[model samples]
Target: MGFPAGLLVLLSVGALPCQPITHGDSAKQDGHCFQVLPAEEGALNIGRHWGAATPAATVHIDMSKVTSTASSFEFRTLDPEGVIFFGDMGDHDWFVLGLRRGKAEMQINNIMTNISVRGGQRLDDGHWHRMLVMNEGDSVRLEVDDEELLALGHVSYPIIERPVPEMRLAMGGLLLPASHLLSPMNTAMDGCLRRWSWLNQTTTWREGAALRAKAKPCFSALRPGSFFPGAGLASFRPADLAGGTAPPNGSWGLEVELGIRAPRQTGLVLAVGVPDGSLALSLVLQPTAMVVRLGNWTKLRLPLPEGPCLDAPLRLRVSPTQLALQLGNHGGTLPNQPPDFQWLQGTWLGQEGRLFIGGLPDGDKTPRPQEWGAFRGCLRGIRVQGHQLDLDSALFRSDTIWAHSCPGAHEGAEAGRRARGHGAD
Candidate 1:
C-alpha cells in the first residue's frame, strides 16, 4: 500500500533516519536538523557564543529517544546541555536545562537569586518526547508534549551582568572544571537527541557549522539498549493462566531466582492471592532483611548478611509449611506462620486469583505506573509447581504487570528474536 501523504510529510519533516553528520559535512547548513549525542560519549560543540546573543528566546527539542534507567539522581539527559543559553565568566551566573531524577528541569542562577522548575512527568520510557522552553521578558514557561508545567515568573534581572571569554554551549553535557570531571554529578546522558533549536523564529541549526566533534561518538539508532533500572514487574490475571490451575490444597510451592538491585524501601517484590483481600503471600525486600507475609501476619524477617545482594543470586522457595531463602551457598528456612483468619488456611486456587512478580497486581489487567509498588533489578528464573516459565515470554505477553527483564541476560533467547524483527510477545 502507498504511504499516506500526511504521514509521509510528517516523517520527512521530523522523523529522519539516524544519519551521522561529520565535521566535513558543510560549513553551514539550515532548517529542521538534528545531531546525535552518543550514549555517555561525544557531544556537539555548537560554538561558544551560539545562544549568548539572545536572552528572550524559545527552545524546542525533539528528544528522539531518551534512555534514562533509574529514578535516583543518576540518569542525566543527552540533550542540549551546557550553558543552555547564557552565562557569565564567573560561571555562577547562567541558565541550564537537563534531566534530574528522570524528570526535566530548568534552572536559572545569577549573583542575586537561583530558581529552578521541574517537569511533572518522567521521560525515560524509551519513547520520543517533545519539549519546549520559552523565556519572554521576566517569565519562563516549560511544556512537555504540549502539557504545560508550572511557569516561573519575576525571574531575577541581569541574566548575565558581564560576558565571559569562552562561554561553552555543549549538547550532551556541561563544561565543568577538570577537578569536577569524575564526580558522580558529571555523568553524561545516555540516549539519542535531535531537532533542537533556540529562537522564536524556527530555523535549523546549520549542519556544517564548525560545531561538529573531532570524532563521532558511537550511535545505537535502535531503542535505548536496556531494561528500566528501577523497580517494576509483570502481573498475570486469573484468566491468563496457561498451566493447570494453581495447586488447590493451599500447599503449593514457588521458586524464584532474582537479584536485589536496591535496598527495599517498603515495597512488595512478589505477591499472589485473590483480589482486594488480605489472603495473600508476599515477598518483600527491606533495608535490613527479607520479609515474607501471609495474610496480615509476618511469617518471617530473615536478616541479610553484610554484603551486596548483587554479588550472588537470591533464591526463594515458599510453601504452606515452610519458607526458604538462599544466597549463593548460604541458606535459611523458617516454618510458615498462618494468619489468625481461617480463610487464609484454605486453598489459594479455585478462585479468581492473580500472580505478580516484581510487584503487586493492580485490580485491573493493565500495568500500573512505577510509583505503584514495583521491584527493581533482575529476575533470573521463576518456577511454580516445579514448572519453569519463561520470564521473557511472560513479560512480553502479560498485560497485568509493568516489569522489564535485563536485555543482557536474555541476549541468547528473546534478544535474538528481537534482532530478527520479532515483536516482544
Candidate 2:
C-alpha cells in the first residue's frame, strides 16, 4: 500500500534539509516542506545529495510515472552504525525502465530524444512493489500513483554500464543490492530472458536438455582443420557421413590428429541422428581436459601447457566399437588408458533427428572458452579401424580402412544418412 511508515527522503549533510514526504502530504509544491516535489524537481533530484538513518525495515519509492531526462535519482540513508550514506542508500538497490518496445522504440541505452522519462524503482526493503518507470526520451519522470516523487532531468549514474544491445530485447528490470550489484542476482538473471506472453507462449524452455539414454554418435568437432578457421575446425555435412540422411540412425565418423605445434588438450563433441534427428555419445578426455555437453552445444575445455617443451598432440580415432583417443609428445605414443576405459563406449550424437558437435545442433554458434597449446613438433598421422557398411565408394572413399569424407561435401545426400562405418581423413 503506502511506503513503509518511516521511509524518510534523505538529504546530503550540507544539502537543503532532511524532509519526510508523507503519503498525506500535498504533492503540488516546489520544495514544499512536507510536500513531495514536482515530476521534474525534488530534493532527490540530480546535483542534490541526500542521506538519512534507516531502521531494519525495507524501503521502496514508487516512481512509475515520471518522464525526466535529467541525470539520475539520488538518495541516501544512514547505516546501522549511523554512518551517513550519500544517495539512495541503506542497503540500496534500484532499477530503471525505458519504454517498452511497443510503447516506445529504443534498443540501446543511448538517449535518442532530448525529453523522455525513464521509469524507476528504489527498494531498501525485501518486499516487491508495483514499480513503474517512464522515459520520454529526454526527461524521465518517477512517481507513485500520480504523485510526483522525484522529477529528475539529469542524475549522475557513473557506475551503471549499459551493453551494446545485441541480445533479445527485454524490458529493463535492474536490481541494485546493498553494496555494489550483488553477484547472486547476476546468476539468477544472466542468460537470455524474455517475459512470457500469449504470442510467446510456445517458448517455455530455457537452457539445458532432456536427452534419451541411447542416442547414437553422429557428428564430431575438431579445432585446427580446414573446416574451422584460425586454429579450429568442425564438420557435420549430412551427406558426408555413413548416413547422409537428416535423421534416423545415420552412421557418421570424425577424426582429429595433432599437427606440428598442436594443443596439449583438445575438446570433443559427438551427436547422433535418429528418426527425429537426435543422437547420443559417450565422451572421454585426459586429466587436463574438460567437456560440457548441454542441449545441443558440447564444449571442450583445453588448458594449454605451462612453459614449453616438445609438441604434444591428441587424436580421436572413431570406430563403431569405441573412440580411440591418443596423445603423444611430438612423434611419440600416448599414455596408457585405465583398464575399464575401453568400456566407456556408446553411439555418439543423436538428438531431435539432428546432430551437433561442439555448439548447438542447428549451428547457432555461441562462443565458449577454448584454448589449445601450440605444437612444437610435427604429428605424423592418425589411424582408425572400421569398415564402411554402405558400399557407395563416393561417400566412403578411404586409403585406410577408416574412410573419411571430403571437406565441405556433406551438406545433404540421402545415402550418407543410411551408410555406415565411413571415417574422416
Candidate 3:
C-alpha cells in the first residue's frame, strides 16, 4: 500500500515529483528523476536510517570483479552540495564525486597525495547529467554527460589499493559516513540518481543479484514493521514524521496513533522531547489508562475500559481547540480550554523536535522519567498524519530493535547492561 501522506519526509528529498516506469513501457531507461531524501544528521555508528543510509538507493559492489576499473552514474538535480558518490579504504584514502557551487567536482585521495578537478559545465540546471570516472593507477579522466570535464592524478596517490571486498555503492550519499575525507558538502545529495555502475564488472549495480539483496529502492513505499521495545530506542525527526506544510494559520498539527501489543502492560508510547519545562510532551500506556502529559506537569488520563492486556489501537490527537484520545473501541474528546486542558494550547509539537518512541535510554546525564518506563511491548501500525515512521530511519536508536518479537528476561538484562555501559560512556 502507498504511504498515507505523512512520513514521506523520511522517504523523499526535495519536492521533486517521481515518474514510475512500467516494465513494458521502454520509453527510456534514463527518464524523469526520482526524488530522494537527504540523510538525517545522525551518528554514523549507532544510527541507521531505513531505505539505505544516504542516497536512499543502494547496491553492493564486488570489489574483486572491478578492482581496477572506473565508476559512472547519471543524475538529475538542482542541488550543488550533495555527494554524488563516495568510496574509501577505511582510512584517509578515498574517491568522491560531488558538486561544489553547482559545478561537478571529482576528488581522489590517498595517504600520500590527493587530486581534485572540476568540470566547467554548471550542472545544477534541473536537467539530467552523466558523470563518468575512469581511474587508472593515479591518473584519472572525469566526464559529464559524455563530455570530458577534467582529468588529474598524482603518482603517489592510489584511490583504493585494496578496496573493501564488498562496498555499498550509493547514489548521492554514502551508506555510512565511512570516511574522514568526506567534506561537509559530501552530505546527502538532494536529487535523483540512476544508472550507477562500479566495482562489479558483469552488470550494473541494480541488476546484480547478490549485491541487490542489501540495497533498498527508497523509503517512500509503505510497509509496516512492529517496534518490540527492549533495550532499544527509536526516534524520527519531527519534520519527517509530520509530513505536512503548516496550515495558513502558521500552526502545525500534531497527532500520534499506535497499535499496541505487550507482555508487560506499562510503556512510554512516545515522548516528543525531553520531559522538561513547557516543551515536555509525551504519551504513555498504563494498566488502567493512557496518560497524555503536556508541558511540565499537566496531564489528561484516557482511561481504558479494560486493563492493559491491550492488543488494539490507541490514538491521541491535539489541536488548538480540542483534544481527543482513543483506545481500542473506546475514547473521548474534550475542549482545549480552562481547568483541565489549558496545557494543550501550546504549539510545541513541531518546535519540540525529535519524537522518541519505544525505549528511552536512561543515563546519568539524561535520566528519563521513571513513569516513562521502557515500552516492553510491540508498537505497530504507528501513524502520524496518516504516515508511519520508519523504524530503520530513526535518527538515533539503541541497538537490537527487534521486529515481530519481544525481548525476554535475558534480553532485558542484557539491555540493562548495555544501557549502563552506554550511560557510563
Candidate scoring better on lDDT of 1 and 2:
1
TM-score, structure 2 vs. true = 0.21
**What is the TM-score of each predicted model, taking all chains together?**
0.39, 0.21, 0.43
Ranking by TM-score: 3, 1, 2
**Per model, how many backbone clashes are there?**
7, 100, 5
Q: Candidate 3's residue-wise lDDT over 245-359, tens digit each?
A: 3556766456777777553356777876543332356777776777877655456787765432456788888765666788888887766544323333333334545577876
- Tell me the TM-score of model 3: 0.43
Task: Tell me the alpha-carbon RMSD of every candidate.
Answer: 19.6, 25.5, 16.3
lDDT of 1 at 24: 33
Could you give me the TM-score of model 1 versus the true structure? Answer: 0.39
Best by TM-score: 3
Error of 2 at 341 (Å): 12
Expressed as tens digits, the lDDT of each residue in 1-425 for candidate 2 is 11110112121111122232212312221122111111111121111111211111111322332122222222211000111111221222222222221011111122221222323332211111122233343333444334544454433232212222111211112223323321111111000111112111122111112111111111111111111111221224334444433234554444444322322224333233332322333232322542322223332334334433213556554433333444453122222232222211222232223322322222324233343221111122222122222211222111111111111112233222222311222
Error of 2 at 72 (Å): 65
Q: Model 1 segments beyond 4 Å from truth?
A: 1-233, 238-251, 263-266, 308-311, 337-347, 361-373, 388-425
Candidate number of the best lDDT: 3
